[model samples]
Target: MVVGSDGYPLPMARFFPNLAIALSRETFARIDAAETVTNLLSA
Candidate 1:
């Protein structure tokens, strides 16, 4: 998950309880994979 300038994630965990907790490795891996794909596409 990304932590914004306020030391919180962009989605704002306080409002979205679903993403508040520490994400599992599998979830993080998925996000990383997506980011990589996005970056490749952008490049």
Candidate 2:
């Protein structure tokens, strides 16, 4: 359970359902690809 600053349990799904949906498998793959490219460039 996630707690808020007020010491109350926060409903993450209720508050950020859209954010959860936005992080789909395709989005994760794109993010992973970007990170891998950055790491290779910096190495």
Candidate 3:
């Protein structure tokens, strides 16, 4: 449901920032250990 400035659909990778935060939280949601993780967004 996301689009670019040109009105074209944006790829999933374009959501890296949101994805990274959601993923990291979900990854440790049920675990006791939490660690900082970095996500690199590249074309």
For all candidates, the clash counts are: 0, 0, 0
Residues 1-43, candidate 3, lDDT per residue (tens digit)?
7898899998766777888888888877735333222222321
Off by over 4 Å in 1: 1-23
lDDT (C-alpha, whole model) for all candidates:
0.76, 0.89, 0.67
Which parts of model 2 have CA positions greater than 4 angstroms off? 1-23
Better of 1 and 3 by TM-score: 1
TM-scores, in order shown?
0.47, 0.47, 0.35
Q: Per-residue lDDT for 1-43 in model 1, tens only? A: 7687788667566566655454666688899999999999999
| Backbone clashes in model 3, listed as residue pairs | none
1-43 per-residue lDDT for model 2 (tens digits): 8898899999889788888887786799999999999999999
